[model samples]
Target: MKEIVIIGAGYGGLRTVELLSGNKSFDITLIDKNPYHYMQTEAYGYIAGRFDMSDIAIDLQGLIHGLGPNVTFIRDEAVQIDETAKVIILKEQRLSFDIAVIAVGAKTNFFSFIEGAREHTNGVKNMQRVFEFRQAFEHRLYAKLQNSQNSLNRAGDLHIAIAGAGLSGVEIAAEMAFTLQRYHKIHSEKSQRLEFSLIDAADTILPGMDPYIIKKTEERLHELGIKIYTKAFIEKIQERSITFKDGTILPFDFIIYTAGVKGADLIHTLDTPKNRQDQIIPDETLRLQGSKDIFCIGDCTEIKDAKKVLLPPTAQVAEKSAAYVARSITRLSEEKSLEPFHANVDGVFVALGGKYALGILFKKIRVKGYFAYLLKKLISRSYRFGLEIKVNAGYKKRHVGSHDTLCR
Candidate 1:
């Protein structure tokens, strides 16, 4: 039996396990620092309190246990991969594997040039940080309410700035704007006015996205009272203010940095060919260059398409590459020829607060407003449902000897 070791429990890693667990010839060991899978794509909603813990986090222990005895789930951190030795170095132990997959995902990039950016700004990349930010925001609102009831003089407008007007920044700014407005209406008290700003150095928000999407998103942000600051390069980030290149110092009550991301720190330690972002440059078959048994997928790998353009490290790309890698591994075990992976993006949906969204399907079909939001929610629900079904089916097959029966 092949001893397969997969690192990280993100979308890619989990999907790979789901596809390969049914194979009787493989023993799968899935390792991750966290015991649950975080739905990072829904981070905006989660931060806005639109989703609870159960909506965004799936218990890895329960899911893996349901996959049968052939699979093992380890809640440990993977620090490095000894490529020459075919071993993974974890914080607690060293693991040897017949085959290895690196899907450790990405980390937020706080550019070194920006002074105090790392120290002053918060991020929504992980659940802990998200929870902290949400709590702090709520406390700030409550404080304002208390001050109003006491008839104390208002300090100033409560400014919340989102640095980097990419997909994450846009979604977060929109959600916060809507939520803050709702909070104001509910309180109906004279409190500190709330102001939101979306800052980016790029010429436009959501750079490299379709022009129509950019236009529509800008419109919605404006409607929701969000200020967009494009081409306003940030030079420094102070404790309560950010300095722009043009000598503009903007003060804020809070700031979120969603400007950029790079491959996880572990990826940089490996002596493998990688792109500028430190993402491994995998071959057409999604294997590490010059290595046959080691594969790289998800945000840790920089994959290009037939046109030689790098694919964005979105969940869609991660899952597609993961599925391909799983199939390639199966073919390798069977001594069959492997096929090259072709990347394709079927659609994209961006929620713009409340029940509004913007989407593009098949690169041509555009959707907006409530229907797009509903579509996005349905897609997210479908993914969760599919995972539950796969786990239940695997458990039933292991105990009842029947693959058709799915245990609820």
Candidate 2:
């Protein structure tokens, strides 16, 4: 069997594994730093205590255990890849592969160059960091409620300042506000705790999204009790406050930095063509332009084609790219010509607090409320069902994803 090693169990990496799970001719090993797959897009809900860990994480071992004898799962971090020798070196051992796919996604840009931001704010990149913020926020809120030390009208109430009102920041703020309101309801008479604020340097939130959608989202967020501050840039992150570029100081108990992103520094560790933003340059085939047998997918790659503009680092693009690559790989193995990847910019979906959501559907129509939530749940269930069947019966097993049935 041919050996194929795939790095990073993110949207793209895991999708590739699901696509090629049953291939008997290839021994597949998927490597990830974490043991379980995280639903990062929905991670804000987890931070807000709206969803539990089980709700956001899938059993990676269970998915592979169901695969039985075919695929192997190695829970390890990949440190380096030697393309010439087709070898991957982890912390302990180096493994060789016939074909390798590098889809390790981008990290929180940190923009550590900016003074004082690193030590003060929590980033939304990995699961551990997000969980840490959750713990911090909860701890402060609980302490405030228990305090005989502070007066009821004192200035020590729980204040959460989020420094980026982009998609993640705004959504997280809305979720946190709603969760805080729920907590406040139970302890209403004694203490008034929990204030949420969203700060963005942009003129408005969701800069890349439709203006009308942005307006609607902004209004809905306000209705949910989240304060939004636009056209404000952070000059420095202080111990208990955020100093704006305009010299205004806002104090808070917790700060979440979801501001900006750049390609991972690891991509620059090698000699590769990079765009102005430093994202790896990839050809239409999704292969690194100047590197042989090296493919780049997801947010780490710079997409320069006119047909498909550089997409936001979202899961949708990663999932689509992974499928395209898996099919292309199979085609190449059979001595067939490969197809170029042309991504269709589908509509964006933003989940509001509770069952409410707003986004363009099919890039033509607008959808919100219960119908959108139902669609989101249906998508998740369909994905889970398809992956489950793929593992149970291998690639030879025929499966259909139909709404009436579970696996459509």
Candidate 3:
């Protein structure tokens, strides 16, 4: 049997396994730092307590068991890729592979625009970071309630600034606005007012998305009292304060860097052509530009569109690329030619909190308000369930939340 090793259990790697695991001719081992697969789309929602943490994770072991005996799961982090020997260097051991697929997803990137940003700020990219921010948020607020109930500016009012007006940034800002408002209404005595801001270097938010969608999103953010700062570059992040390029300092209780993302660090170790974002440049067939046997997919690779422009890294892009890569691998075994990976996006969907949302479907249909929110939920559910190719043995739909201390 030929040994096939896949790295990273994000949507891309996970779906690739589902498509190829049924083949008895191949022995597949999936390696990921975490044993569970997380639904990254809902990561921000979980931080805001809109979704359960457990609901967002899928047990990899359980996923493999249902796939068949041909697939295995390894809970380990990938450190390097020794392309010369065709082996993956893990934290503990080196594994050789006849065919290697690198799908290690993106990481939160604080570009050079902000100095000391990643060190001082927080984000909702993963569960751990979200939990940390929630703890710090409540701890700071509770401390104020106990010490300064009579202080000005709502005692411990928080000034939250989300860097970058992308989808994640906008979603986080909107959800926080809703959650903070809800919290104050419940605990009027100990509550603190929250100030929300979305700062971006670009003049427009969600630049590539339809104008109607962007307009609707701006309106919703306004209604939710979220301030928008466009064409403003964050020059520095120092001790709960953000300084713009103009030397204006804005004090914030917490800062989140949704400004950008770069590919997994492992990609830099490979001798492959990469873009500015550290994303491996993949050929039309979804293979690394230099190697035919080594495949790269998901957020880790930059695959351009028909217009020769790089496509955005989204779950849909990852899933579609995964499918194409799997098909290519199968074709390789059969000595058939591989086809190019094409992306066909439905449109953009923005959840603006509190029974409100905005979306553009099929690049034509405009959806907004409560109807858009429901549609977003429906689309999310459909994608999650559709990807579950294996029967989960130990995976339970349990609820693990944040902000428990504040509720008490």
Candidate 4:
């Protein structure tokens, strides 16, 4: 049996396992730092207390039980790789593989140019961060209400700053705004208004989204009284406030930084060509250049187009790469040629809040309102449910997803 090692239980790695598990010729070993598979796309709802923590995560160990004995699931951090010997180093042991896939996902990036941001600001990349953010947000509101500060008394004092106007940042801002509205409605006397500020260095928000959608989204956010600051460069973030490039300081009760993300640290150590962001550059076949046996997928890999521009690092692209790479491996096992992976931007769904969403379908069709929100929920659920089946059956008939990505 060919020993196949996958270093990530992310959308790419887990999907690859689900696809290749039934191939008796390939013995699969999956490794990840976390034992549970979490749906990051819809996690803001959980952060805002609209959904349960249990709603977004599926126990990976439980899922692996369904993949049968051919597959082994190890919950451990991958430290480094020795490409000369094709071995993956864990905390204590080294695992050799005939074929390996690197899909270790991304983490919060405060954009290195800015100082003191990562150490001070909040980020919601995973469950741990989400829970922390929820606690901080709640604590701020609790303090304000306990002090009996009415909406008139607390204006900018209850300020919340979100750095980056991308999907996650904007979505969380809307969720918090809506949640605050619900809270104020219940206790009219303790109506402490929150001031939400969305700061992005970009001249415009939602870089690749439709103009109409952007306008509608801004209008929706305005209904919640959110302040948008475009073309605003962040210079530094202190514990109590954020400083801009022009030395403008905005005091915030708490801040969430959702600006950028790159590959996990392990990917940077590989002796492969990498982009400026330290993302591994893969060839058209998703194989790491100079190492045919080792493939890459998800946010960690850089699969650029003919213009040398890389695809946006998103779950949908990862899904496409995962399926294609799995098929490539299957063909390789049978000594067949591999196909080039050409992933098109299908569309994306952005939840403005828990109940409202914006979807750009097929890169042309624009969708919004409640139906878009329903579609986002369905997409999140389908992936989780499909995983449960894959965990049990070792392999399930393929499930297709619309080109739905939250972040561009």
Candidate 5:
């Protein structure tokens, strides 16, 4: 059997593993620091307390065990990949592989040049961070309510500033606003007590996105009472305040840094050719430049199209790249010529507050309101169903003589 090792259990890594698990000729090992796969796309809802932990985290061990006995799951951090030796250096031991895939994903770009930005603001990159932020946010609201009877000063009690104003930032702000509205109604408190501001260096929110989607999103944000600050370049981020390049200062009780992301730290340490964001520059076939045995996909690699336009590092792109790479690996084993990867973004769905959303399908059709939200939910369920069905099928294949209904 050909030894195959995949690092990172993010969208790209997980999908690739799922695609290749049934191949008996390949022995696959998946390595990641966490044992559960965190559903990052559903983070905003989780942060808003609309979803539970189980809704966003999936047990990797259980999934892997069901995948097949040929697949192994290792819960360890990957420190380096020595391409020359065809070995992966982990914190505990080294792993050798006939084919290796690096899909470690991206990390929050705190813009290290800005003073106190990384130290002061919170991020939702991982489950732990999201949980921490949610807890802190709820606690602050509760504390403010308790002190409302004793103190007249509640100046910045519920002030929230989200830096970035991108998709993540916009979603977070809208969800929080909706949640706060619900809280205000339940407590019979004035809505003025709650304040939210979405800041971005770009001239408009969701810059580079479709104009109609951006316009509708802006309208929704305005309806939610969330403020938008454009072209507000951050000079520094203090614990309770943001200093802008134009010498404008904004104060807040809490801040979320959703500004940007770059390739993970391990990607930066690799000796391979990397872009400005430390993402590997893969060839047309999505393999590491000049290296056929190593394939890099997802947020850890920067892939450009025929027009030289860089693809956005979204989950959709990651999954597409992953599927292509998995097929390419199988083809390589059969001594077939590899095909160039062409990324096509079929659709994008952005969830606003409550059951409201905006979507662009096939890059032409547009959807709005509750229907868009439902479509997004349906799509999420379908993706999860795909993964679950594989697990069930694999389980039946291993234990039973025939494939049968094993899950309700």
Candidate 6:
């Protein structure tokens, strides 16, 4: 049997396994830095006390354990991939494979435009930071405010500055606004102070969103008592104060950075075509531009077409890429013709506070409220079930033979 190794057990990597698992022709190994696959969409809800941790996290082991003897799941980081040697080097061992799939995702990009910004801000890259920020918001910041001796002290106000105005930034600001207001209301009854500010570089929040949706989101955030600062750029980010372009300084108790994302730094080491953002440049077939045995997908790759550019960073794009990859790989292994990987965006969904959401469906149909929320949940469930089916099918076919052979 030939060996196949996949990196990063996020949507793309895991889906590839689901498609190829249980094939006796190839041995599969899935590697990731973390043990659990985190659902990025619901992470803010978990942080805002609206949802539990388990809702956004699933054990990678549990998913693969059901895949039986055909697939092996390892908890390790891919330090480097040597295309020449056809091997992957981990911290503890090296994996030699006939084909390798790279799907290591991107990380939050601070841009380093503002000095001390990276150090001073709370990031929403993973689940831990979200909870950590929430903990600080609730316990530390509130405690500092409540115990202040001077009523005129700046600490009592507890200003929060969110650095970016993109989708993640907007969503976080809205959630924080709503949650903090509820927190303040409960605490103020017993006499405690709280305040917040959401700042963005653009003149308005949600830079590219439709005017109606943007206005609605802004209104809702304002209703929660969160101040919005438009057309503001941070010149300096200090430990306690953020200085803007016009020399205005604002003191902040917490700063959340949701500005942008860059491809994983590790991908820079690979001898593949890379974009300015350091994302792998893949051909129409989703294979690394020059390499036949190697494939690249997800946020780590840039998808190009004849007339227009495309973004391959979202979970939706990653999931679709994985499906395309599965079919392509199967055809290649079976010595069949290959097809070009074309991206068809089904929809785009952004969640606001609580059950509120704003979305543009396939036909540009705008959606919000309970129906959009329910659709989001169903999409998540479908993803989980799809993964489960692939693993289970592989295990069922290999279990008895492997068990009986081991006993003999």
Q: Which candidate is the best by TM-score?
A: 1
How accurate locally is residue 18 in candidate 5, as Cα lDDT from 0 to 100?
Answer: 88
- Compared with the true structure, all predictions reach lDDT values of 0.88, 0.75, 0.80, 0.81, 0.88, 0.76
lDDT of 6 by residue, 298-328 (tens): 8888864344555536888887888888788
Residue-wise C-alpha lDDT for candidate 2, range 107-175, written one tens digit per residue:
776665557888877888778898887887777777767762365564356788888887888778887
- How far does residue 56 in candidate 2 sit from its true spot (Å)? 1.9
| Superposed model 2: Cα runs more than 4 Å off | 148-155, 304-308, 384-408
Candidate 3, RMSD to the unseen true structure: 6.0
Candidate 2 has its poorest 10 consecutive residues by lDDT at 399-408
CA error at residue 48 for candidate 1, angstroms: 1.3
lDDT (Cα, 0-100) at 331 in candidate 1: 95
Each model's TM-score, in the order given?
0.94, 0.90, 0.91, 0.91, 0.94, 0.87
- Give the per-residue lDDT digits (tens) of candidate 1, residues 102-151: 99999888998888989999977777888888899778777888777777
Better model by lDDT, 1 or 6? 1
**Residues 24-99 of candidate 3: C-alpha lDDT, one tens digit per residue:** 9988889988878888887767767677766677776766666766777888889988877888899988899988
| Candidate 1 CA-lDDT value | 0.88
3 or 5: which has the higher lDDT? 5
Which scores greater on TM-score, model 1 or model 3?
Answer: 1
The true-structure Cα RMSD of candidate 4 reads: 6.0
TM-score of 1: 0.94
Return the clash pairs for model 4, or none.
Answer: 66-391
Off by over 4 Å in 4: 149-156, 188-191, 305-309, 390-408
Clash pairs, model 1 backbone: none
